[model samples]
Target: MVTEASETNRDAGSVGDVAARIERLPISKWHIKVRIVLGMATFFDAFDALSLAYVLPVLIPLWTFTPAEIGLLISSGFAGQLVGALFFGWLAERFGRRPAVIACILVFSIMSLACAFAWNYSSLFVMRIVQGVGLGGEVPIAMTLINEICATKGRGRFVVLFELVFPIGLVAAALFGWWIVPTMGWQAMFVIGALPGLVCLVLHRFIPESPRWLANKGRRAQAVAALDAIEREVAGAGQTLPEISPMKVGADRHASFKDMFGPIYLRRTLVVWLLWFGTYLCNYSLTAWMPSIYRSIFHLPLEVSLRYSLITSIFGVIGGLACALTVDVFGRRKLFSFALLWSAVALLSLWWTGATSAETVLIGVTVSYLGITVLSNGLYLYTPELYPTRVRALAVSSATGWLRLASIIGPTAVGYIVAAGELKNVFLVFALVAALAGLVVMLFGTETKSRLLEDVSP
Candidate 1:
């Protein structure tokens, strides 16, 4: 009992030492470089994810696909993503984050090139799932890295700024698709999407592995060394270093997978899973289905279909930016509740219109997306905050598995619903989902604003 008590105290001290070291560091040029390097990975993931939505406008007419085939085509990539999220979550925990990140980048980058050469429906289908293994793994791992690095004071804004790269990538896809698909053909986007892989070559040069991760794993020497390097970089950038004082942490700081599924974490797991499922179900359905909806349902020209979709993308990005700026001020729970309820209202408005014309659907979808887009990106910031370092990546990645499931179900449901000529009913279903998510969050979600990660989860 004496030896065990002493060991527990030592473990508690180690966790505090690492958290204090990181929390003292200020925002510097080195941090920006780290964000830039990781930001490119997600920028292209978004670009690649959105690329399929744009490509489908051409493929629907060229390949002559039915509703089921189109839905499966959209869903196939998500199936691979679900695999990537689970596998890499385990990989990041078992191995290290840097290795898992580099491997996923290479996999997706190479597979993206394979997608470019796809000869037919079956060929592209296989390539996308394989490519998705990379795309799905990148963002969650990236989020875990950024969250681990940031000081507690600026974490929300800092992480969300990095996440904003994702929506910007979506906008870039829309912007580039307007010009490129009309001129260079559908193959060009895949070629462009693969370019973020080049970032993998220089990743190790810019950022070090997380000190918190090393500390939690009981590699105290390595964790201190990593923190020392960051301090030197901050000092080199002409910023004064604050004195390190160890924080007080809960004994639960050292965690395992079984502990994660234990009663302590079960409620957190369920709440975030609901947030993940509701947010993405509305988000991907609106984005992936819109171009095809404009082209097929209304018989719009291809350029016009993309242009209308672009308008909504711009509005959605506005919502994303607004959410990032205000999260710290408004608090995570309130902001999440507001965005979910707001979207529920916008989507329900479409249901009230009774199967409207194309322009009306466009307006309602854009309004609905404006709110849902906030949750879509902000979850990257919120999910990581709710877990300790040992299982942070695993937990975030697992929560995002619901996102993969939602993406698959959302678009496929839209496909079947549209095919059945129950177009407005899609908005009704999305509204109910959004509203339910809001109520759960408002009632059960913990407020994590301005707390150290160790304090929030521990």
Candidate 2:
């Protein structure tokens, strides 16, 4: 295995020796390929995560599910997600990031398709839980890989690039749902959701095992080979090569289950968990219940309401990309705080406009979606960076599990609000949550700007 020790030996040769050998590996091509793989996996993450919302606009009426039952179905995925995150984090530690990620995507994809075939409410609910597990695992693990691979100088760019697709995927799903739900029905929308994952599965084969994992595992030969591959790809177009330093490979890996609770990481764990929980609470509330909210308030046709929802979703994608572009330079802490403040304002505005005309409400909804997306997409970029490579998957998963727990709370709260005709109160409460999330992040979260992945850990 390639350990830090092995790197010293590789560096012992004339500095030129490391440079020549490392230059032989293909870095640019592989980087692009890996980024594509991560993005594609996120596509499934995007689809499965939000697909429930699209269905809610249809399923509630078709099946005559009560508000409480509909809330249950929406949140069931998050419960499964919590389990998947912790388990996959452990599994990634036991096996490897590549295997865990691929397995999670495949499982979720199949289960999402299974949702299409669900014969009753119970069956659908069960499949959603199973599907949630897979959804939970894929993103954090993929993020672990991406964070490990990119240079510290370029890490923010890469992480942002990694997150940009999530909004796009949701927007796509919304557009498709709007088009198909009326004609082909909700079932076909889910079947279509399954297709992207299959494509991702086929593409996933090309993604290599994470070099960081290999180095940590003491697989020196494979680790060196992987690094060499990345170097060569980067050296394309006749760029001058830099010396590569090899790390030692033969020690026992430092990552352990207990490391998650280590003194160095414990505080980080709490902050990230809170951030995930609070942000997700606001996000899922607007998402799972928004279409219905629009329908009730605006009295629009089903298809038209869905179309409005889809347009707002596209703005979210825009917000995500904008945040990604500036996060590193502007700083994660600043962006997160700024986004949260806006999210709070937007949510409150949404509540205030509840009684207004359809046009005014539509504008409020768009602003609300924009704020929430900026808050979420901006902050999630920080989750994997909080821990070292060894425990990164675990840390990220732990945080994500909290997010699922929030999902359980957020939608259930929406049900209560709706039942009591207190949807406006729900928005105000979520706005406060959004503001608190921002405060926690601004005060507690460390700025990862201009630091190597390993450097940021301690």
Candidate 3:
């Protein structure tokens, strides 16, 4: 009994020590190395996730697809992502971040390959849903791992820089669609999507399991070992680490789905849910439908439609990069609210103009894309900061599961709205949603800038 009690106290002490050590460590080459490897994996993830949008334009003409069928095909991956996010999130919480991330990478990569061989719309749709599972699971786990490893002072910039690859991936996909899809066919896009599987080997070789997660799980020895490895690298780089402030250690407990809805986390849970849903609803409604709209409504050639869509995606990448640069400077709440408000105004403008000319529509879509991209990508940095380490992956995953939900509904709604010849109403609805999202964040969201994760959420 005496030995057990002493061991427990030591473990508790180690938990607090872990966070302090991580926060005090100077940003080093090791940190950049980790981000680079992880960012590569995420880049491919973005490539695969949005590759379907580009493919849909090709598939529609080849298969003679109806708008509703097109919506279903677009939504299939999101449906899979919803399941993947929740399942992998639980896996990360119960198992570890490393294995969960690797497995998700493998699953998505293989499924992306399978997408290439799909003979019909049904087969392609099924493959997309399965691919989405891996794609959906990767983000929350990746973000959670990055969040735990980063210091509070530069956390926003670090994570956002890491996330910037996602838009880069989208831009790459758009360029591929503009060039490759027209030349080599849509199967080539899936071939590119499957390439990320190679990243799993690199991740397995370099990335360590999050030390904070190990400490929270009471595996103090391993946590110390991981931290020591990172510290040695920082030391080897000739940067002296700052002294770690002693923190009060609490009893370590296992986190559960129930914990997400507990009183302390409930408001954050709801706010992030609204944020994810509203942002994705607005985002995918425009992006997923743009190339299709250009093709069918404007009667543009496939290459020209893709080129226009690519321009909008480039604007999105620009917006995401801008947010990454400014998030640490201006803070999360203010930027998030402003982005949504901007999106709302842009969407309202599009609705008022009635998409009369291709030029008018492109300008409106570009502005809205810019605003929505900031909010959508910035959520990656913001959401994980709102939860404690124990439930951090789960909360982020669950919240993003709402994004998947929006991904599903938004496209399907666009299908019907476009079918009814009321496409302007789509903008009006998304505008209201964006306006509401801005208000919710302004009213209820907490600021996490420069605050330690433990202090912010605990």
Candidate 4:
């Protein structure tokens, strides 16, 4: 839907007329409103994703959960997320992003209610798996949709700021869990998470479909209709629409999972998979298990454990904010390489000096969280940019399959490692993974700083 500054691209292949229209539109209040609608979906997705972690402390004692069982329960959601990512990616390409996202929200919110009503461990475990499917699918599809609408010049900060809500959701969960879980019950958190579903009704009314997606599907009239909607919004906000530039293009709507492994995209696909796996492995493991570590290993009060975990999440929000401000200037490639190494160093410090005290462990975890979470925020922006509109949702959602995998592995690994009284090894291993991913990215990653979507991928 955006620009390509490359003179070669200008001559090689046109970005098509619909994409040109999207590229020329100026930023306006309309953009902000659309972001809020989409951002709210991801906000609740984050809350529902982490809801299990906050509830685990209470459930551990309530149900007499072993560490192995704790890991299984945590990993179960991610296991479902993996499936959701692939299926929804296809659904987005086949049906449309709007319907796919709406369906995902419904699936998770309704299942979250079922989770609240779960009477036993087995029932909740199954419910989380179903919920995970929705959780995994919403984000990649949403990111692709946002990228489709965004102009290239400021797209990095625009999308990253929108994605920033994800971390905010984590913060809200931790803070609310600290308060709500102790007073009311853990089930209230799931009930609170279901609130995003209410917004789904009003969503299609506010935001238009991705015109780039429409045109790519060879539905020229629908693409023009969506662009007409966006223009009306911009006009209502007291702005004159600029004239669109010349564009001549051909459709490449046959994009599928196969193209991602072809010569053009294979390296990027591999590097992005590593980034997703390593980043989420480190991130989810720490967030999901830190409260349990504080409660069980350090003998902290339940409230205190949740509060410390909340602080760590706030640090992660700070990391994401820093990314939003600077990713445009410094570029995605350099930032990713540095942040991954930074995460490796922070976590490795804990292993090097002996992770003895709860306070020390919290400090190390917070520092590691700061560096690693930048990838969590920026990858949403970076991943979509790596592919064109034809395959953007498919590639991004499939990449998130790696995130779900890491999420599954990380928590399960923590449960067993902690169970074996070798907690420091957790940091040691995650650090190595981070370092390895950083190296792969530094060597192989392409710089997609301000280029238009068509130029980069096509």
Candidate 5:
């Protein structure tokens, strides 16, 4: 077995030897292939995560869903995601990234299928919660694995480019709702989400476990085998791989959850929590309710509401792409902080405008989406960079778990805030949150541009 062979080489290899090998390899077809496969899986993950937003507009009329019930349905998945993120993060650490990811994919896909078969709101809600577990787990593990494999020089671009697929998934969901819900039904969306199950086979067959992760686990041979597989592909393509760097060996320290608050990581951990909480709080608060807001408040037709929401999501994808293009160049701290502040200003503008006209609302949403999407996508790049490989996935997942808490509170608050008929309050509240997030980043965030993961975190 690979594990047995790795045990034999454990004493022969120094710490970070495998990471150095991985970091030194130039980008090649093998890297592109892995990104494509992972990107496809993420596309569906995004699709399933936001599919409920579109589905709810249709379900509201059919099931007579009240605002409170709507909040529960929207938050149920995030509640599951909180559990899944922590559980799967631990599984990634304990078992392996490859197995944990595949398990999460299967769990969500099967539960998504069950969602299609749901006979009532309660049934669908339960399925969404289960599906949320898979949705929550896959992302942090995927980011951690990508971070492990990527070169530092362009790490932000690589990770953010992969994350771009998520907003694309949102756009796809909006389009699906625009076209499908009025004709076929809401259940069809879940059926499409279930198709990602097929991606599980491709992932299992092709995606290698993170060499950094293997090396961290003291499975040196397995780590080398993984790196060698990529090196062989690079070499076969007639490109000479770079020589591995001489890595400084450090004590093999196992990270615990308690270490998250230790001096080295405490401020970083707090900044990330604020970032995740604020970003998702603003994002889901606006997005999860947009379709319904358009239909209920603005008195637009269902098709028009979905289409307007689609336009806002298109802006989000554009913003995410802009961030991916510039994050490495602008640096993580400056770009993230600036984007958050920009979003806060946009939300404040919306609040001042009274959010009275569709034109005013659309413009506000477009600008806010642009900034928030950048922060939303950028957080994935930023979070894992804060921790060493020993606790990378766990820290990222745990930090992101704050997003689930915000998700629950944000949408539920929207229910009450919108219920009060003072929609402007939502903008004011989110604006303050975004402003505070920007301040936190400016005050405490570390710049990770062009630095090796080990150097930045360790």
Candidate 6:
């Protein structure tokens, strides 16, 4: 009895130590604040990305754009995203994260407002492409920032929570579009999309530059100052703090993008690149066509279909949070592989539902959406772990840029598929691709759990 009590006390002490360490991580508060801001930014992202989808139901009738022309407008932003990811990733390396992120916000905000003024399909398409650049730039840089600020143990939680903002944005879009598009018009949606960028501009001014980024850039004094401020913030709350050794990260000498593809990173690069392509393809396919798919199959009113979409978005957030809590415990490879396998099964069930009861269809779609949300959150966590500080943003952005290229193709291909009256068969393709993606990940991807951020690699 005495020995057992002693062991229990020791365990309690260890737990206390861990809690204190987590509390002392430089960016704990910053992470929370940034996620709140990211929620708003992601809301705009979803709003702008899907604004056309909402508008399409209204605009197709207004403008008489053929399926092909409508497809072009839908995909134009994705094309811009493809270019923007690469361009901004490169620029982030040169200009630092704070400037790059703010710049992207401004570019997208101004261009989205311009979209509301477009008189014709051609002008709207051009504006969308420009807006995509800003969209692409925002996420990759944000990911880079989050990865740098968060400690390794808290990484999965931080990344997953931040990622959840994206789907919430989509839900807000659906809600806004459902309410406003019918009352005011589709143009009002774009006007609404411009609001968050202004909010971002103001919020960003108060949030200091990332200490980790400063360290990675060899700005030791600034990094130390940032750390001191963080320590003061914690101390002000009357918390005991852990001692954090000051360490410089990244290269003193400038490194090129080619470094990402070198021998040390070759295997990691390949896995992350493929993972981005597969997961993005899955996410875009479902989100882009959700309203249309509901419309065609359920024959419901636009508002009712949108309500179901909003419900799914809610479930998506829940699913993301669940992943955030459990992913670090389970390991990225294991959780993601399971998410993929189940997503494939869910997609197959969705295909099966096309011939079954309405209730079954709803269940299937819900499962698939939930699974994909969990899987994508896993990728967001995994992608940043694969690269070192020197090339982290560039590596993540490179994969995302290519992934955006796939996103462009996924939605447009769906448009073509729908136009051909073969919408029912498309779920099968999604299932197969998801299955293959899982297999690839399971076979080739390295496990990353309980490892330091610097230790995660090919």
Which candidate should be chosen as best, given lDDT against the real structure? 4
List the global CA lDDT of all models. 0.86, 0.75, 0.88, 0.89, 0.87, 0.71
Q: Measured by TM-score, how close is model 2 to the native structure?
A: 0.90
| lDDT rank order | 4, 3, 5, 1, 2, 6
Clashes of each: 0, 27, 0, 1, 0, 1
Q: Flag clash pairs in model 4.
A: 3-452
**Candidate 2 wrongly placed segments (more than 4 Å):** 1-27, 200-204, 236-239, 245-253, 352-358
In the range 203-312, model 5's lDDT, one tens digit per residue, is: 98889999888878888667777876777787788777765665764667776787788888998898899899999999977888899988888989899899999999
Residue-wise C-alpha lDDT for candidate 2, range 1-458, written one tens digit per residue: 22232355653222223223433333456677777867887876887788878877777777788878878888899889999999998899779998898888888989989999998889999999999899999888888777766665656766777777888888878888788788888898778767656655565467777776676666657766666555555555455554444432222347876766788777777777777888789877677777777776567888888888888888888778778788877988888887877878877887776635556656765776676776567655687777766777888888788888999888987887787876668778887888898888888878888865555664
- In model 2, where is the ten-residue run with the lowest total lDDT? 11-20
Off by over 4 Å in 1: 1-13, 251-254
Tens digits of per-residue lDDT, candidate 4, 1-458, equal 22222222432222377667778888889889889999999999999999888888999999999999999999999999999999999999989999999989999999988899988899999999999999989999998998889888899999999999999999999999999999999999999988989979988788777888877777766776677768777878888777676664555557677879988899999999999999999999999999999999998999999999999999999999999999999999899999999999999999998899899999999999998889999999999999878888999999999999999999999999999999899999999999999998899998999888888887
* lDDT, candidate 6, 202-232, per-residue tens: 6566456666456556665565555555556
lDDT comparing candidate 3 with the true structure: 0.88
| Residue-level lDDT tens digits of model 1 in 1-458 | 11222133454326787787678788889889999999998889898888888988988878889987898899888889999998998898877788889888888888888888988999999999999888888899999999999998978888888998998899889888877998999999889989988988899777688878888888777876677677777888789776566577865355577655777678888899999999999998889888888889888899999998888989888988888899999999999998999999989999998746778888888888878988988899999988888899999899999999999999899889989998889999999999999999999998889999988887
- Residue pairs with backbone atoms closer than 3 Å in model 5 (clashes): none
Candidate 6: C-alpha RMSD to true structure equals 7.0
Q: Which 10-residue span in candidate 4 carries the lowest summed lDDT?
A: 1-10
